[model samples]
Target: MCGITAIYCENEELTPSLLYYSLFSLQHRGQESAGISVFKNGTIKTKKGLGLVSEVIKNSDLKNFESKCGIGHIRYSTSGSSSLENAQPFVVKSKVGTVAVAHNGNLVNHLRLRKALEAEGSIFVADSDSEIIAHIFSKSLSRKDVIGSLEVLTNLLIGSYSLVILVNDTVVAYRDPLGFRPLCLGEIENGYVVASESCAIDALEGKFLCDVKPGEAVVIKNGEMEKFKVAESKEEASCVFEYIYFARPDSIIDGISVYDARKNMGEELARESPVEADVVSAIPDSGVTAAIGFSMASKLPYTECLIKNRYVGRTFIMPKQELREVSVRLKVNPIHKNIEGKRIVLVDDSIVRGTTSKKIVDMIKKAGAKEVHMRIASPPIISPCYFGIDMKSREELIAANHSVSEIAKILGVDSLSYLSLDGLLKALKRCGRNKSYCLGCLTAKYPLSWSEDEK
Candidate 1:
């Protein structure tokens, strides 16, 4: 997906730095590009480019800007090619005023909608699905009814979207009816903030208020807040993968603590597949919490067998397969003392293409592990995610084509086990999430449908 942040502050000078740090907290959500759009002196000024938040926006740049309302975005393309043209916080002129939009989640109907908009002579600058929302919302603003425009905007599209739109100085935060992505509102000094996750709000030292409800829009203006039901709520399908992989452990999403959910997943996995091992180790960062829970439940000694390099970005999101392969080696290293002569139980979030998993297993074995029994916290990802996740093709997914035993052999592991779908739901239930979360990647059953043209 992507990271989006919006701030409406009485202290205009604080907006830039607040947005900058908020985006930095969410840098894991996206790494391709970073951007910000600020409303100042009756106009919107946008600065965006291809890079990390720190690489694109500097302290000097933040100090030079001043605004009462602003929005920022960090992006990694699931729908469009990675380039400056596809970067977000996309600004456009609307009938209401100057509008800037930042979106997280994919629109399954984007291609068809784009073709229709083109037939009616709407020009397009980028292939990003997010740009589609900008065009539709800009046209709907002609109705002069903000809520009514949001109603119209929601009805015409399908799939997931968590949006932060800046119409002049007003910031509107909207979550799609299915709630396939995460968005939350927080209270900052003399103003309010909306972001992709609560961690961003925490980074700004803001008090988190609540999640932006499914099918609801929260509008902030002049330091006050207003709420509206722009669309009818459907069966909630909040992305389950967020807890398993994407979100920071400290963040709470939809009342469920991400760390607790992952730990519970590890516990469930331990019950489902108890393994004989000398020590338990994690893939690092994302997998650490689960590995801890696995250790607790299985009564295995927890050890740091693999050490991650902080400098390397996530290998799964690397732009090319070749780059991903090379980065897997640079991303983590085996601690020979811990791994040598040990029967290692390796825990990780999920295996997408199986390349990185295979590489890691090989490295652990080469470091003298007697056996590497791989355990995945989530169920095998046998289907593609249409909402916002990067895995778009079933062909690219290893579990889609191979059985568990085959995959274990391919990865050079002694054995392999994935958390069952039932086990996943049960773990989430313990986190107060119930059964409403989306399991499309694991079950091949999606909340929405897509056309062949869009696919």
Candidate 2:
């Protein structure tokens, strides 16, 4: 997954700082790299590197980026190597003019498209799927009108994508036909903003207008906003994982509150798999809200038995297994006083490989907990996520290969229970969202057609 932001201000004063703060709010979505591009004096200038937003763009750099319109991105490398070359907002010179694009989500047909483009003499500078978008757009612009070109390009592409492009002082934001990712529009005092999540709009003190509807594009130019239907899909398949794990709890997605959805998940889990425990605790940040709901439903005392290291980023988003293990230790520590002699109910979001869950269970046991009952807020992730998430192989999923009882034994937990698929849907429905969601990773079903090998 990745985070993307764009701003178009009426006044000529630079708004790069606003982009910076917006990206900071979205830092949770990606951490490998950060970048920003500004359109100034009929030229698009970009600065990017491999690091956190703070590490990559300095205050001085923002000051130097003097422009009224700009785009920014934070990347986690779902489609390319984690390198500076793959970092965006990618600035390219198209026949129409200079354009910079920042993208979130993955293209399922990237390899085939890349080969076709290469056979036609398209020279790619970066090993990113996002670069392919730039090539297609630029090439199409050479012969077709802007809207027609975009429509054709959108039709040719498959899988999830939320894009922000800066071209000729206009900031264009578009979400794919299936709506497999989140993208929204917000209004600021002197301009408008488009971002991957609503939380970034809140961070910028902007009023959210609404979501850029599935297959819709919103263009912002000189503070005026216009909407266009670039492409259309018969069904909507917004990624449900965003509410379960990817999105910040405080954010609202597709008119549903992420925090409320998670709490409801916990409540459903409690009703489906009630456990008698002395204390109810969470696996730190992601699991805290659900644990609270579990405590309320189970009438058990809620306590912070596991204290998280505030400095450490999320371990699951880390790209490597060894790094994930090392970071897990640095990320959380058990409070012996609270855990000792206690029957603990541990609530977590999901278990992918069972590595972190095993370590956390071991840590709780070593802290003298008499028993650890694992409760996952979402259904077992038994399938790969071909859209954008990093869980790309079913072989890496422990639940895909082992039974729940076997997984419990592997983790050394007294018992394991995951929220049922029906329960998950019910919780989301309780949030009052009337939209279909993509549960491909949990259900092994996709809204869009894909090749057998791709699946």
Candidate 3:
């Protein structure tokens, strides 16, 4: 749901602009809003807003900042209403200095937790799940412990999270016990880095340190590092969607190659749903990987039938169905030549809402594709995700509302096939998890023992 970074430098060379540049490396991870907090003099000053990283800061925007230890965030807005106040790193001024927190992932029991804290006179500024965490850190002074306060907060919360807390001068990184999210450690020439993904590390000439383990909290102080491991929460169920579609193709999560895993998903899709097609084509960007796998498996030459316009911002508000009509064409345009009069096998990661798929099918047909067979590498996305990635209601999902064949006809595809529950499980096994992978979204069987595990 968000990308976060924190670094402690040995020199004043770590400027706000530089931090923004480094955080920009993970910009693709989130695009709704961006911001940063700097620990300067004895206070943490922050600049955050509802825009992309470049839109949020300019060369002169940070002219007022003077900090060495800082935290930066790019949010996709899974937890809160989209507003300036919801942007992070959330800062609170306390008697013991300032505590600023930037967090990734969603809290499952956020509403309940917020109500409980509010009953205790805890005032919240934003509708985000992250505000509670900031409040907890603010009160860490009363408990006379930072880690203990975090532990108390973690216990009271549920769902995925990877948090970076900048307490005056120190950077503390922690992940939820279920390992439902990813946070990694990186080392720069002058300092250490902690981010939601490793690509951010490579962007700054930082050496790749291993991932921040599940249920672990790592604190970086001066030139030393300390770690504390909390008990695991239920089971490890890192969101399979991260590997399937969300994380960058170049990144690695839990030792699985994002690109490789996706390719396997596509290959498995081909094996499970063999179709006769003259050309194999992908939707673009992430879909390109799966298309290659499908091409390899089918022995059909892969063609670039569709090209995506990268400039479009993430998540468009379709005020009317008429405007939504052009979203697919605005996002992707068909290369009529390759698709003309050919049997095309279309590959995409998943179909949440059918609008895009329906548009894509129409585009292909309009481009003169003889037959368009749609294949999704992952199973149909039925339920809404509570732990991040942004699906507000199960009702919004096409799969949840319509049957597979019904969806295929609605989309106007010659045929449609979604990776089966077993196919998805096999693909996960092929991803080769050091720990078990979560297929809850596919099977409706959460790895957690929680009551919500029931559909």
Candidate 4:
């Protein structure tokens, strides 16, 4: 998944800086590329490149991008090559006007749609599925009916998407009908903002308004906001992974705190699988919150047995297996004083390929730990994600192919257990009859169906 933010403010100069800081807050959502598109001097000017937000769009770069309306994006390559061409907040010239689009979530029907568009003589500049939206909206444009154009755009596409588009002086943010990704709205002084998560709004010192509803389009123009229904409402299937891993813990999604959800998951995990160990420790970063919950529930002394390198980016989002392995080595180190001569219970978010977990277990063992009992806060990921997550195939997932016992053996742990599907759902507070979240990765069932070609 990627991060997208859009702003419309009365104070024109503040827009660029606000967008920059918003992108910086949501940088964890994506690492491959960053960009911003601003409406300046009666034209939309865009600057984008292949790098982190700080690397590509510096605060100094905002000096010349003074505008009242702008959109920004940080990208991870779920559907495109990691290159400069695919960097977003893509600025396109359309017959109706100039539009810039920044999108989060994968479009399942992109291949067929792209081929069809090509047959009609649409030349695509970038291979990313996000670009497809810009092309479709550009073609569907009617200067007097922006919402009508969006309705047409939504009807043709199938799959998850949370989009922020800057069309002329107006900014529009829309979430897909099924809402497989998160998008929220916030308010600033005489202005409004929309982002992939509320934390981006908090970064700009704005108060979160609410989540952008599924099948809803929020339009901001002339410092006023209007809401419209652009598609038929369906069952809300927000991505469960957002609470488990992707989102920053401080952010609240769909009226639930991400931190609380993770902590609850840890509590559930401890209840489901308790191991006798001297101390409880986390894998670092993502695992820390859940580990705390596990500690609170199990009454085990929580200790910082592993210290993470602040400079290293998350290894899971690294594009290549070799890169991920190398980053895992460089990311965290075991504390000898905490790990030595003690049985350690390692709490982690999830084990996808088992490569990082195995290395971490090995590291603790080498640090003189008596034993390592692993506990995962979420259920086993047995299916690949089609709605923007990086996992592409079952073969890439260890749990998809191996039993829990086999996985524990492969990781060289004393024992291992994952939170049951029921436990996970309960922790997320979706334990009732309705399935409000997507568990496509944990269970092999998805919210949407696709042809073999879409896969």
Candidate 5:
């Protein structure tokens, strides 16, 4: 999914540098492109491109952007191509005023919505779900109040989205009824900040505020915040993947500790799928927590076997497949000392194509591990993600085509075990379940129907 952040302040300096720093805190969300829309004098000014946050914003560039209300985004390509127009926060010049929206997660009904708007003479710039939303709000200009029109707009749109909207004097954040993506709120000295994770807020030294609840909208204006629930409907199937994989380890989502969730996932994995091994290690980064859990549950010593390169850019589009391979190679190098002559149990989050996981298994063996057993924190991903995740087709998914044993053999792991669906549900409930969550991709269910064209 993509990451989005915005702030509204009356006393703090409205420098673009502030947006740059905040967006940099969220670079993990999107690697394809980045942009920010600044609202000043009833207009939304925007700067965007295909690059990192540091690459997109410059010293002179930030100086040109000055506004009390602003919205920023880093896009990971989902619905659109990797192009400039697809970058967000997309700004539109409407008759009522200038409106801009940056979004995370995917809209299932995007194709239908875009066609309807186009038939009604709406000129489009980018092939993106965010643009459909902006045009819908643009059509409701007669309603005047930004949030009210947006409320109406939300009802017509279907699927998962965590939206941050910017207009003159107002910065608002809205989560879809199912909350398929994570968004949080924070408070700075003189402003209110909304971001994809608490990490972004903490980066700016903002105090932790609660997550934007599913089916709710939070509006930050003139240093004040207001909340509104989605119109009377309460059924929300939030995305379950946030716990097992996605989010930053340090961030808390929906009041549940993400690290705890992962650790619990590992514990459950050990229960559902146990294997014999000498040492338990994790694929560098996200997989480490679950590995710890597995190690604790299985009573195996946990060791740091994979060391990651801190300088690697986001891993979504690596410029080329060759580049992606090199990047992964450069990012993680196995520790021969930890793995040598040992039967290693390697824990990882999820396996999409099985390419990376397979390579990792081979790397450990090459580093001197006697045996490599692969353990996945989540169940086999049989279907592609229609959400903001970059996985595109089932054809590319190894599990979708091959059975578990087949996949294990392909990866050259001694044995493989994935967390069961029951385990995932159990892991989340461990943190206390106050809200409904979406297990669409895992369960082959969705908040909205998937069109054949989308496939």
Candidate 6:
């Protein structure tokens, strides 16, 4: 997945630095690339590179862009190769004017749409699905205005997307009909803001307004905001993984607190699979909230038994499996004093390939833990995710090929238990998020129809 942010300020000049800091808050969403595009003096200026937000957008670069409105993006490539050209807020010159686009989520019909555009003699610059949006917007401008163009584009698209488009001074944001990704609106001092999460809005000291409804398009211009219905879906399939793993714990997505949902997941896990242990310890960051709940429910003391290396990025998101395997130790280390001689209940979000989980359990054992009981807050991920996440093949998923008992033996844990699908739903309901969710990875049942070749 990716993080996207847009801002429209009426009373003061837009600070690119503020956009930079906002992207910093969303750094967890993506680390491969960072970019920002500003509408200044009737032209859209953009700067982007393949690196972390701070590495790509320096303090000196911020001074180069000045405007009353702009959009920013942090990308983790799921649709395209990791290259500078694929980095977003992709800016292009259109017949209407200069239009820059930033997008989160994937399009299942990207190849089909791209082929159709190419047959019409459209030359593509970037390989990303995001560029398809810019091309569609540019082509639609020949017949319709910005809003109407978005409507036509949204209708033709078949997949998950939360998009922010900048046309001159107007900023348009829209979520796909399925609402597979989160995008919300916020009220800034003299204008408005739209971002993939409310945390980005809070980073800019903006007041969160509400989530942009599924199939809804919002336009912010000249300090005024307007909302439009672009398309409709019979049922919304918001990604549950956002709360389980992706989003920042501090962020509230689609009216649910991410931190609370995670905690509830841990509590439900304890209720469903109670474990006897001296201490409940998280696998760090993602698992911390759940571990707290697990500790409270099981009446086990919670401790920071695993110390994470602040310098390490997420090992699972690393591009190569070998790199992921080698980097596990660099990412976390067991606190010998806390974990030694203790029967540890190791709570983690989910195990994808089992490589990292195996290494972590081994590390804790070597640290003198009597026995390691692995507890996953979510159900086993047995299928690939095509919407936006990087899990693209079932062969790469350990759960798809192995049983729970086999997995536990493989990891060398005393026992392993994953939260049941029903348990996960109960936790989400506890957080008042009873809406339909995309559990395709857990059940191999997708919300949208797709060709066998796509999988």
TM-score for all predictions?
0.99, 0.98, 0.94, 0.98, 0.95, 0.98
| Whole-model Cα lDDT of every candidate shown, in order | 0.91, 0.90, 0.81, 0.91, 0.82, 0.90
State candidate 3's TM-score: 0.94
Q: What local lDDT does model 6 show for residue 85?
A: 89
lDDT per residue (tens digit) for residues 1-455 in model 4? 89999998889889888989999999999999999999998899999998888999877788889999999999988998988899998877888789999999998999999999999988988999999899888788854378987887778888899999988999999999998899999999779889999998888889999899889999998887999888876589899999999999999888888999899999999999998999999999999999999999999999999999988888889888998999998999988999999998899998889899999999999999999999999999999999998999999999999999999999999999999988988998832233488889988888888887889
Candidate 5, poorest ten consecutive residues by summed lDDT: 313-322
Q: What is the per-residue lDDT of model 2 for residues 1-455, given as tens digits with 9 covering 90 to 100?
A: 99999998765564888899999999999999999999887889999999899999998897778788999999987888988999998887888899888999999989888999999998988998999998887788788866676797787888888999988688889899889989999998899989999999999899999988888998887778899998878989999999889999988988999999999999999999999899899998999988988888899999988899988988878988888989998998989999999999999988999898899899999999999999999999999898888998889999999999999999999989999999999999999877799999999888888777544
Model 2 scores a C-alpha lDDT of 0.90
- Encode model 6's per-residue lDDT on 1-455: one tens digit a residue: 99998888774445586678778988999889999999887799999998899899888887778777889999988898888889999887888789999999998889988999999988888898889988988789878998789888877787889999899878899999889999999887777888899998999899999999999999988777999988878988999999999999999998999999999999999999997789999999899999999988899999998899988888877767787877897999888999889999999999999998898899999999999999999999999999999898999999999999999999999999999999999999988766999999999999998777655
Clashing pairs for predicted structure model 6, backbone only: none
- After superposing candidate 3 on the true structure, give the runs of residues whose Cα lies further than 4 Å from its correct spot: 315-326, 448-455
Error of 2 at 148 (Å): 1.7
Which scores better on lDDT, 2 or 5? 2
**Selected candidate, larger lDDT, 1 vs 2:** 1
- In candidate 3 the C-alpha lDDT for residue 327 amounts to 62
Evaluate model 1: give its TM-score: 0.99
Clashes of 2: 0
How large is the C-alpha RMSD of every model relative to the true structure? 0.9, 1.1, 2.4, 1.5, 1.8, 1.1
Off by over 4 Å in 5: 12-15, 314-323, 450-454
Backbone clash tally for model 3? 0
In candidate 4, where is summed lDDT lowest over 10 consecutive residues? 428-437
